[model samples]
Target chain A: MVTVNGEQKNAAGQNLLAFLKTEGYEPERVVVERNLDIVPRDELEKVVLEDEDVVEVLRFVGGG
Target chain B: MEQERKLSKDADPEKDVQEGKSLPDQLQIEDPEEVKKQMQQILSKEELDRAFDARFPKEMQQKFRGARVAIAGLGGLGSNIAVMLARSGIGHLLLVDFDTVDVTNLNRQMYLVPHVGMPKTRAILQILYQVNPYLDYETVQAKVTPENVKELFGGYPIVCEAFDKPDQKAMLVRELLGQCPESTVVSGNGMAGVGDSNGIRTAKFGNRLYVCGDRTTDVGGGVGLTAPRVALCAAHEANKVLQLILQEDS
Candidate 1:
């Protein structure tokens, strides 16, 4: 189980892009940090999650 | 100070009495001397600064004057945020925006009717100057991109992200946090709609970021984006900047 925002989840096998979609977060509106390192926006599809990995997903909603 | 009566030093009271000039002393409702006194006292910049410093606590007045902050996107959020910070007598402000003041922006933004066609940076600076003429302002009339964000805001210790689109906001937050390690960013996320005003708040994250909004309301969702809600969120963002500045010593 990988941790997403300090919570354990069965997301180790999923790629970052797919995990963001399944969690209902718009990929364009979020910045992901995998194991304390920022995963650049263009490289979200290439990064694969691993067990015991800690991820922090920060989402920005629409509006000013 | 209202200019009700004309100040004519050369008028002859004797000639007016003979010619039946009707503007007598008893004809005015307000005290003419009081009005003259109010009009005569023009505040110099030092006096204005003193008046402003009286409102701020003693320990933080110098910090407010020395603080330098940058704001991106001069729409509802950035315009109002600039006004607040300028009023507090901030020393320097780097204003960035690529749009002109439109008729639609008058309802929520700080621009006036005559400022419709002017660039947002210039129009907002005019208002900020009136708020505090002592402030030093640097304007860049260009759009913010991920590639240029760091170059534009690298020197500012604090940056405010006030973009309208979610993607643009995310891009700014990501770029700043990634490129400028010393910069602290305050952003407005979801401040549309007339929801509970209390729902709008400043949420601090990981010491470098503070977002002020409900974080759920979307402008496109059609709940409505009113001036009061947007200004409330701006106040939260401005206050967070002030709070960060105040706590820098601690």
Candidate 2:
């Protein structure tokens, strides 16, 4: 199971860009980190999610 | 207190298990619902377990009653999560915290008037006893540093990270993930501020990680942590803990 934005989903074998598109992300300006390393914009289509990957889509939101 | 077992440490698990194994004996008793409804002020350990077990499916209850979970930090998130876990009949809990309860914490954390100066571990134990007296709990009142985080939380099958600060949460999550591969960490991340109550949620991260709360709402960022949101996040963590227990091998 690959975890994306803290939620585990069947994203292991997914292409990062395709996965993000399926998840309703516009892909204009989103920062995605897989295994704590940033995946560059061009690499989103090339990066295939592995079972051991931890992907977090960081966004700017206010805290409590 | 540095550390101690509270309330039910004296509870004889051998006898409790023996009595619980006699499942057929419960079938023999007539008016099970009435008996369960009438069960107030539990007098014996057997009655206590029976009342607690009545609401759960026998197999699920057995799994819940046999599991041990740990909560680190024991403040708003940890304290509330511990109480909810005990309510679910988790067999044992390892609670660790070094801070003392203050008037400020009464707003969101689980602490009473007299518990103001009491150590968080002791106060949480006092509250847990009130919720489930038959449940076993081991408490430690000490700061969890990177050096000792693994040793403190390694034995638990499910470890909940409920600290207040980002650094503490980061350190605990990082250490537990890297060092304690055997434990699943259910953490509370963005439950600060009273924004949208519905925004708080539980999500599984990776294989052995679950983080609850809105992933972005943080404390000290023009807002503050409140009771309803924090407790809601705590309940999410507690629910995830129970799910992890019942969903083993699923």
Candidate 3:
């Protein structure tokens, strides 16, 4: 079980990039944080999630 | 009792400064016209600054006196942010934009009809200086790319993200965070349409990136951009920058 944006979900065996795509976030538009540390854009595909790992995904909004 | 001296047309203004009296006082006029005439004197820059500083509380004025800020993109967000920072006496600003003002942009952007064809950098500079002549502006009319992000916005402690495209905003933020990891980047996202203005807010991404506006709101869902919401987001960005600057001194 992993916490994605405060919600408990099963992401124990998935890479960060796969999990983000499954969650409907575009890889280019979103920033991912793993366990309170920012995961660089290029490292998303390689970084994997473990049990009880925390992740936060944010995206930029344009208009102004 | 001292006798009143009669004023002459050729009175030596220098004599009043040498005397113990101020020049206006030395005019010794009961008529309003004479007082207006005496008040029309040139003031030195130091004297002008003293007058400008009189408007704000001493502590705030001191904090913003020499601090520098850089704003990227001079559309709705950047324009309002620039004006707010200038009014607060932030002292110096670096503005960058490659686009010109269009008639469509006048709806939400801080530009007049006459500025439709002018480059955004020039238009924003004119408006900012009009708001505060003491401000120092460094403007560049170039698009910000990932390759030149660090070079264009380096040296400034804080860089504001005011681009109108998601890809550009994301690219700049990613590059800025990677290159200038220590500097703060203020950005706006999700400020479209006109429902609850309160939906807009400021969110902190760790210690280096601060994003303002309704994170979920965008141009999708049949929504269109308006001035009220955009300006609110811009206000949040500008206000956050002020808070960050003041926080450093405290």
What TM-score does each model's chain B reach against the true chain B?
A: 0.82, 0.81, 0.79
Candidate 2: list runs displaced more than 4 Å. A1-64, B1-42
Best model per DockQ? 1
* Residue range B43-121, candidate 1, lDDT tens digits: 3577876786678786788888889999999999999999999887778999999999999898789988868888998
Q: What's model 2's lDDT at A52? A: 73
lDDT of residue A9 for candidate 2: 91
Q: Residue A26 lDDT in model 3?
A: 82
Model 1 chain A, poorest ten-residue lDDT window?
A31-40
Ranking by TM-score: 1, 3, 2
How far residue B217's Cα lies from its native spot in candidate 1, in Å, is: 0.5
Cand. 2 Cα-lDDT: 0.77
Candidate 1 CAPRI assessment class: medium
Candidate lDDT values, in order: 0.84, 0.77, 0.81
Highest-lDDT candidate:
1
Cα lDDT for residue B236, candidate 3: 97
* Model 1 steric clash total: 0
* Chain A TM-score, structure 3: 0.92
Q: Give the per-residue lDDT digits (tens) of candidate 3, residues B22-130.
A: 4443433433333333433433447657876788778878788778899999988999899999878898899999999999898888887767888888777666655
- Error at B185, model 3, angstroms: 1.6
Listed in order, the DockQ scores are 0.69, 0.11, 0.51
Tens-digit lDDT track of model 2 for B1-250: 6975556667654665644322223322223233332332334668777876678788888899899999998888898888898888899999999899889998888787877887888777666765766778898889998689888988789999888876567657767876787899888878777788889887765567787889787676767878999899998999999999999767
C-alpha lDDT (0 to 100) for residue B246 of candidate 1 = 84
